[model samples]
Each structure stands twice: as C-alpha cells, then as structure tokens.
Target: MDSSIPSISPWRLSVAPMMDWTDRHCRYFHRLLTQHTLLYTEMVTTGALRHGSVERHLRFNAEEHPVALQLGGSDAADLAFAAKLGEQWGYNEINLNCGCPSDRVQRGAFGACLMNEPPLVADGVKAMVDVVSVPVTVKHRIGIDQIESYDFVRDFVGTVKDAGCSVFIVHARNAWLQGLSPKENREIPPLRYELAYQLKKDFPSLTIAINGGITRNDQIAEHLNEVDGVMIGREAYYNPWLLTTWDAQFFNSAESSITREAVEEAMVTYMERAFKEDGCPWYAIARHMLGLYHGQRGGRLWRQVWSNHKLKPMQPREVMAVARVALAKGAEVPA
Candidate 1:
C-alpha cells in the first residue's frame, strides 16, 4: 500500500457520487485538480433515464474521462437498460447505488433498503454486468438500521460478488432508515472503519473501497493499507485543494504544476466555451471552483466575488478580473 509506487487499481481513489453536487460542471472542475482520481456522476435514477432527457442526464465534458455513472434502481431490466445508456454515453464505469438512505429512494424500494434484499441487488448487478463491458460496481453501507451484525453485510457481498460484481464501495456506517434526514444520516451514525477493513479481509479477491469520516491524507493512506481505495464525499467538495497533491501523494506521479491562478484561468476558458456551445451560464461552472483557494489567505473574498449574482451580466473574463481583485484585497487583510 506504499504510495511511492503508483497503484495498479483504477479504484485506488475516488470522489463519491453525491446527489446535486457531483454534476458535470463539478466533475469538470474536479478534473482540473486531480487527473487520476476516479470521478462519478450524481446518482441518476433509472426512472429519470427511462422517462427523461438522456442528454441532460448523460452528457459530460470529455475531460471528465475515467468518470463513472451511478444509478439508483432495484429492477433488473431498468438497471441493465440504464447501464447500457451510460456505456453508450462514454462513461468508463457503471455503479449501482445501494448506500443512499433517503426516503425518496426508499419509496422506490432501492438504496440502503436493498441491503435486506440481497438477491434483488445481486440480480440488478448481474443484469448490468451482462449488458455492459465496463466494470459494474455497488456502493452500500455496512449495515442498515439495527442490523449491525457483520454477517449481514458479508453475506450481501458474497451474493453480489457471485453475480460478477468485483468492486464494492463500503460506507462504514449504518444507514439509520428512520427519523433521520439524509444529512443527519451522514453524521449521526458512528463510523466503524474497522468493519470496512474486515470486509477487505473476508473478500480478498474483490476490491473493497471504504468511505465515511475520512478527510486527511494520512487517513486515506491508512485506509488504503486495509482496503483497495477510499471514496471521499463532502470533504472533497468543500476543500478540493486536497486533491492537488493526491497524484504525487497517492498515485506516485510527479507533482502537479498547476497553480490556483492557472486553474482559475482554465475554468474561465471552459466557462466561455460552454456558454458559446450550449448556452450554459458561466456561474453554473464557477460555483464549483469557489473552493479553488480554500484555506488560502483570500478564499472568502474570492468566493464572495464569484458568488455575487450582480456580476451575472459580465462575461466570464471580466468577472475573473473582479474576483482576482477581491482575492488580492482579502490577502492584504491580516489573519
């Protein structure tokens, strides 16, 4: 697990597929920071793909290569059809969501609820694997509600692996099904990383990637020693600068030459192109990069300038000038 040598596994590190957060614009911005870390789209429901606009759900910048599409559904036929659509749209992998505990997903009879129905999860995984050439994976919690016994999850993995799913992303917390908002579900449950390590121990042949309560680079390295990879969620989004060092730190690549300013300029160019090509507004993309200077001296003022709706009429380049001015002004203030 020493990171001095580059990892051979594609799932060695990843950004979690958070709903409404890891959209195409966000993925495009993230791609600027770390090229090797696998990215994923928000959980696109099977019903959305079947009845909604395919382009709106599947379109992504070519730069977001190595990205995966995460699907939320329990039906075998729907999953297979959705997986085919994702593959056809140039996604590198197809992931099934069995980890989300939102009531919306519960109403659809999927997500964390599917853990109690392992055969259904297995059927969906097999159905997708049968149709897609790309790897089919699942993201799930260690246990649901009061089901803390390790056997519950171990058997779930055993059944799904038999259906040709070789990778599992384990969120090492129980998805408390009742009386908790999704945000609370992420925080209220006690993180049990050891359970994820045990999963790796039991299913040595399958790639097991752990998620939950992992933020620092040291924590990521420690988990990699026990599991194949780590999937970062909120931390990765709010403090994306953490990704700038990942290639050299985890992938063993040369340090990234990009500076915060250079990344900002690159995003500006991307914004202009997006607007001309698809009538997409620049703010849609700029919002994702507000954390580009996170933890730096001028981050707040810089973010304030970018988030200001009054600047909507200005072109992206002009807004960049204004933001840089604010950033410099903020830097003059003492800590």
Candidate 2:
C-alpha cells in the first residue's frame, strides 16, 4: 500500500501458491523481507471452505496485505461461494488453480483437468467475478499431458478471457499428469517460456505472468522484459532472503539494510503476538522461520539449535534465546 509503488499494472514479482508452503505463517515471515512484492496463499479446496472451518482457513496477519487466495474447484457455485468468503475475509485477489496435476485434485475433477474444459472454467470465473469486487485471476499450465501446441493454451486463454478475467498466471511447463509424481511434474516437464511470451504478444490487454524454474534476480529481470510478471516457487521458500531483497533490486525501493540481529528481534515480537493474541502454536509459526537464515553465517547452527531444542515443548521466547546464542557463534551455515 505504499503510495509510490505502482498499483494499476499487473504484479511484476509474485510468490507462487505452493500447498503447505505458502501458509499464513510463511507469508507473515516473507512480508518482513519485502514490502512491494505480491504473496499468495496455499491453494484451498472449495469443498474444504464450504463444509469446514472457513474462518480458520482464511485467517491471516494484517501485515500480509496485498495477498491473494488461491482456490481449487470446478463447480461455479462452489467457487463463487468460496470467492465471496475470501472477499469478506479481506483478500486482495482470488485466484483459481488450474495447473495442479495431483491425483487427489483430478479425482475432484478440477485442477489441470479444467484446462481441457475451458468453458467450465469460464463459467466459474464469471460467477466468482459477479459477486466479488476483487480481481478473479487464473493460474494454469501451458499445456496438459502431450498437448504441446501453442494453440492449446491460446484457445484456453481465449475462452476464459471472454468471461472477464484480465490476469493469467501461466506456468511455462506442460504437466504430464499420467506418469509424473507431483514433485517430478514440477521438474521433468520441459519449460516453454516462448509460449508465455507469445501469450503476452497475442493478448496485450491481458496480464500474462510466466512461472517455472525462475530463481536468480537476473533471470527475473530478463523475464520481466518479455512478460507482465514473474512468479517464483520452491526457490523462494527454500531461500527466502531472495525475496527480502526484491523491493530494492526490482522495485527500486530503498534497500532494507536490516541485519540478521534485527530480523531475529522482529520475529521474537511476532512470535509472542501470534501465540498470545492469535492463538497460534509456537511450533506452527516457528517451522516457517527455519529457512529464514538459510545460507547466512551461523544459520545452520542457529537452525540446529532451534530444531533440536524448540520442539521439546518450550516457550516461544526460549527458542529465540537459543537461536540468538547460535547466531552469535558466527559459523558458516549450509543452506
């Protein structure tokens, strides 16, 4: 919400919506490192929202503003209802997940399978858009299984666009749902960034973001020259400091020169507040911070000290004390 940061253009940098990885605790910690970049929530199933504790699933920190919620489902009514719940919970945007190829997702008749039924996705988008003022976006793969033609993606985008979606986050790889494990699906699929670039060329009016295997800042800058946005996944989570420096390197904001000591102090405060006020378990939030100092001096020692001691049912403040001692030793930490 900084006045100087551009608001109207599509996001130039975004964190991908990875299940079990982009939860509220993870987003809260990432926010400390970057203020301008957009963050996404783990994908939530529409069934979970309709029949489960919707409030608990949607809870997020106030600092994690400009966050988007990704929903997984194919039914228009369920998706629309879920989008309404997301709006009421104060999300900046609602994203439909059409790229996941897991078997569990396929059984629900959603995810990447929806790519084969573009009209159904369009109907779902239209229904969600009608009820929420926030933007309804879509994240999808370039192609599913062996359908490698550019025309396959182009037609999918074309159909969905007619339903009033202005933003499309395209994972540059084709998902081989039949043979690949979800983990292998992310790696084994060959990336076709050219298809995403072509999408930008064809639909100049729509926001086209390219995602898949992007990690380095230089690569992100190069991708930005051709696409509307760049979304980073596993790399962002494993080495989060990459995002902490984004506001300065990409957005040209003043560098956050805050040191490891300062970040630790901030986390201590956050941990206390979350445990006392939000009723979050100490370990639930602590798990996300383990990678915070991933490759820094003494980081592994610091992580080991916490990992070895903190889970023994100690207080959150006690864990911070152990981490501070390990960090003081200044040893090299393996990432």
Candidate 3:
C-alpha cells in the first residue's frame, strides 16, 4: 500500500533546539538575523512547565514568532498538556524531542530512548495533536544505540506520522546512548546524510528537514533540493552571522543582510530594556553576541570587549561603545 503523503509546511530553514543555548534570549537574538528562519526553544520538560513556574518556562518575546517549543517527555498526557501550554504561549509549532541523548533526559525515559519505543512516541504525538491547534512535530536521530538499520528510523517515522506528525527534523547520525556523552554523540557518530535523503525518498509525503553537521549556506542549498527543509545547530550559534544571509539566500528576500553594527545596536537596546524592566545582567545578553563579529576585521577584539567580565557592571550601551571602538581600530586578529 502506498503511504499517503502529508502536506509539507513552510520550514525551509530552522535553528535546532540546543539545550542551554537556544533559550528565549537566544531566540530573540536570532530573530534579529533572519526574519524567515524558524527558531526553536531549548527542550522544556513537561515537569518544568507543569510543576515549576509555567510562565518562566513558557514566556517568549513577541518578536520571536514562527518559533517552535521543543518539549521533552514520554508521557502522552504530559506532552498534550505541554502542547496546549505552547499553543497558549503563541508558539507556531509544538516539537517533540526524541533526539537528545543526555543522561539526564534518559533517566526520564524520553529523548533518544523514545526512538526505541515507537508506540509510546505515537501515542504522545496523537495526544498532543488532538488538543493543540498548532502543528506537532518531532526531532529525532536516524538510528539509536548500535542499531544501524535504516528501517528502524523508517518505521519510527511511519508510526509517528500516522499519529498526525507531518514535519520531522532528522539528525543524520545514530545516537550511541550508553558509551558516548551528549557532546560525543554529536561529534563521534559519522554523519550519514544519505540516510536522511533516502528517508525523504521513501516517505515522499513527509516534510523531512536534515540536521547534524550541516554548517554552510551551500550545504543548506544542496539539502533543500532533496529534502523539505534544513535545520542548523552549532554553526548557527557559534557563528550566528551565517543566519543573516539565510533570509536572502534561501527565501529570495530582496532585503540585504543587516549590518553587524545594526545588529549590535539592536541587541544593546534590548539589553538596556531588559535590565530596566527585568533586571537582566548585561553580560547575560553579551555572551550571546560575542560571535556576532565572527570573521570580520578586529572581530576578536570586539568579542573580547563584549565578553570582558569586568564590564558586567557597565551598562550595555557603554559596552557597545567600547566594542565599536575596537572594531574601528581594526586590530589584526591571529589566524
């Protein structure tokens, strides 16, 4: 029997949900770079949202629209309740996190371990979809542990798709749940993009966005030819300037990429406002902007000035002024 292909959504480019990295502050920062690229929150467990301060976990800036909330849990009821909260919080989509391989997440019986139990994942997806008006998606690995069979992921996708998940972000690597640390899982496993492409071919109706080790604009361009979308992780954070070009490069946007100076200015304004309204420390915002200069001339000096802990007490505008001066001096950076 031919599987009915689902209608794909507008998910051409997305930033992967990095724990501790892609928080609300990071998402707001990313929104300044590319208006078209979708941003995701760090995985918020159902426990945190339900038992802890719900507002703190679910709150987000209005500017971070088209953003998705990635939820981590195995319980169908918890996931459904969390999805409902995400909808209430104005998230464009609700994403199930079946990709993380951290030991902490494993203890909860969710994350990559859920990949081994397709029925449970399916139930969670169905429950979330039934209650939430927004789309429910899943991010997962190509395989789990020592399992290398393509059929493992193929069946996983089939089962969850039946439960109403049409969009999938597939990290093109097997998650070694036991021996490797979370960081090692990202680096050690060889990326098998072909597996992702093949999955797209087999499940022609599903929206398959390839993740894992994709670092360049050309790579994103190339993947879009075969799959429905592309999701970038470390590269998007460590060197976020890459995202500035995505709006024009992939979305045919006529607006040129915003100047680095403009981005810095906007962030400074945000920092000032946040501090006044919420008492946010300047360095908390500055840490995310250290890579804004990236490869530009005097970029290192500018980064150093912004990240200098001594300036933590200084206002964000003063830090911005110092960074601008450093860039103006154009000090030679070591190769």
Candidate 4:
C-alpha cells in the first residue's frame, strides 16, 4: 500500500457494496460503529441514474464521509455520465461494479459478464475518469464461470490499470454465474486469497483490497498485513457488533463502544430526524438495525418484540420503547 497512491485514502477498512443490504440506512448504522472505516453504497445501475431519480439513488448521510458509490453498468458513456452525477452529488469515490454475478446483472450486460471483457471495462473506467475528478476504482472477481486462470485476473488488472484505475477490490472468489444463486455464488465460489496476495505482489503500485467471507477481527488483521485493505460484507451486516471494536482494533483509534441502550437511543434520534425531515418510515430504517444486538444477551427477544410491534401504525419512537423493554429483560439472542 503506497502512501502516494492518489486514490488510496488513510482508511484501510471498508464495507462491501452489497446490492440491497448496503443501502443508505445500513451505511448510517455501520458508520455509527466505526468512525474511520470507508462505507459504500449499494450497487446503483447506470440505468437508475439515467432513467430514475438521481437524488433517490445517490442520497446518503453526510456522516458517511469518504463514502464510495458503486455503479453497475457496461456502457462507457452511460457510466461516465453517471460518474459525473455521483461526483456532483458529493461522493468521495465512484467504483465500477465488475464482480456481481446475478442473472439480472448479466442480462443487463454488466457485472461479472464484464470480467470476460476487460477492454470494455477499461473503456468504462477511462470514461468515468475522464469525466469525474474523483478516483474511479473497480471491484471484480478472480475469474468468472469455468475460466479459473491466474493470467485471466492479471490481464484484467493490467488492462484496467492501463486505463488509469489504480485501486482494485478483489472478492477473491470466481463467480459461477450459470448454476448458482447469488447467495450460493457467495459461498460456493472457493476463495483464492493467495491469488489476491499474488496480485498485490504483481502490481505493487496498485492499491488492492480483498473481499469475501472475511468475518473475524484476526482475519482482518492478517489480511491487512498482505493486502492494502479488507472489505467485509454479510458478516458486517449480520454481526454488526463486531464493528464496534473496529476503531480500536483496526484503525487504532480511541475505543468507542456504546451499550446496546446507547445504540438504540441513537437510532431513536436518527428515526425522529428522518421522519421529520425525510418522511422515512420507522420500518424502512429499523429493518437494518434488527441485527444490531446480535450475539448479545437478550438479542432474540429484542428482535421479536421489535418485529412484532414496530410494523404497526405507530411513531418510530414508540417502537424504540418496545426494544427498550426487550433489552431490559435479557432475552436470548442468536449469534
């Protein structure tokens, strides 16, 4: 990890850009846990920006500074136009999504399908770089389908690097787009982290961040010793409490652990502000926080109580009251 890489920032920990799961609300919650971590928006298609509401797709809390917006598309012009929009809207970075393997993404002619066409990806990155002053990065898999060669990824990186992309986030697993569901695609694809480490060795100038199935703090620490950064996905979402320790453990920042009560209280304030200013429903934001108490004493009961009562036609603060009671009782919560 060269300190001189123009796009590489001081933050070495990042949240992966999950499609439906890493939305603005989720990013807000994750930001509450760690101050120095880089957060990412969910994958927003180029079509969404061109044909849909740019404001709706790109809106995020200012607290999520150094946030990267991941764009999903194959066309260079469309991607460039969308990247410009993201820059104008105040995103710190614009990341091209080249790793997703869902059938819908493939049908749209992007995602892992672009992995087989590095030239097109280069062109897309070049277009984005030409338009936006912000750094344009790429997230991709080692390979796609049955093509598991190391040269495949090396060439992919080489091609994109030639187009001025210095940052690469490798998921460390190939995408079996044909037979596997997206959930299965995440698990079934065997991780080849050694290949990612080799990539760092091969392109020492490029800032490489490895992602996929990374859960524990020790694993994050170990990978950081090799790669420039580490991106955590589902584990960060399902077991968010793990992030409470990130500032101290990863960033070497001051310890910022808050009790579950404080977290819920913060969420209560957030919900009130959202409802008053943005017309955000309680459930819309609370859905992401259901896992906040995960692995703690009385977690399940808190979830059950909130799940049953929050959906009713009531104020958001009222639902917080329910969660407060559940937490006080010390009900069993799953890890």
Measured by lDDT, the strongest candidate is 1
What does candidate 1's lDDT look like per residue over 228-253, in tens digits?
Answer: 99999999999998999899998878
Q: Regarding lDDT, does 2 or 4 come out ahead?
A: 2
Total colliding residue pairs, candidate 2: 0
Error of 4 at 274 (Å): 1.1
Off by over 4 Å in 2: 1-10, 309-311, 330-335
Highest TM-score against the true fold, candidate: 1
Once model 1 is optimally superposed onto the true structure by TM-score, how far is the C-alpha of residue 33 displaced, in angstroms?
Answer: 0.5
TM-score, each model? 0.97, 0.94, 0.95, 0.95
Candidate numbers sorted by lDDT from highest down: 1, 3, 2, 4
Total backbone collisions, model 1:
0
lDDT per residue (tens digit) for residues 55-114 in model 4: 999988998887999999999999999999999999999999999999999999999889
> What is the lDDT of every predicted structure here?
0.94, 0.89, 0.91, 0.89
Candidate 4 regions with alpha-carbon error over 4 angstroms: 1-11, 309-311, 331-335
- Give a tens-digit lDDT track for model 2, residues 47-109: 999999997789998899889999999999999999999999999999999999999999999
lDDT (10s digit) by residue, model 3, range 1-335: 34595433468899999987898888889999988889999999999988999988989899998899999999999999999999998999999999999999999999999999999999999999999998899999999988999999999999999999999999999999999999999999989999999989998988999999999998998999899999999999999998888888888777655898898889988988888988888888778878898888899889889989888878888888998888878755454
